[model samples]
Target: AGHSITTIEGLEKDNKLHPVQEAFVKEQAAQCGFCTNGLVMCAVSLLKINPDPDDQEIRDGLQRCLCRCGTQSRAIRAIKRVIG
Candidate 1:
């Protein structure tokens, strides 16, 4: 699978965040928030490739992320809301 890596700083124009980032904030999903941006981007990108992924597929998508934050479930829920 081919994927493009987009940094948190590069996700916008005029030095602003993308809407997905904004949405994550709105959901209050950013506790500590250290890994929030990367998690959000990863979720968005994965859903674009596999919109209706099963639980195991979602886990596979996140396998390389190595999250320290405990917001994984929230991120997965957001992706499912969009794609499912």
Candidate 2:
């Protein structure tokens, strides 16, 4: 297969957190940490597809990643922060 793969770790460079990662941290989006990776990855993908997605679009984009710790609101806020 000639496909490229990117994991959450690949999002960082020069010891700096990606904007999405920084936003998530700033918003306190990770509660239990279990779903953080998936959420971050999904957010990255979502932004790649729609750089200026609205709130509803962000929610729809993250639907596939489940965060059982109830950090969805903060995560949404984080995404909005990245959007801005």
Best by lDDT: 2
Candidate 1 structure quality by residue, lDDT tens digits, 1-84: 797667777778787766666656656667666777667777667777987888888777876665667777776666555554
lDDT of 2 by residue, 1-84 (tens): 899989999999999999999999999999999999999999999999999999899999889987779988898999999999
TM-score for all predictions? 0.64, 0.95
Candidate 2 wrong stretches, greater than 4 Å: none
Please give the distance, in angstroms, between residue 50's alpha carbon in candidate 2 and its true position after superposition: 0.3
Q: Against the true structure, whose TM-score is highest?
A: 2
True lDDT of residue 81, candidate 2: 97
Evaluated at residue 55, the lDDT of candidate 2 is 85
Q: Whole-model lDDT for model 1 versus the true structure?
A: 0.70
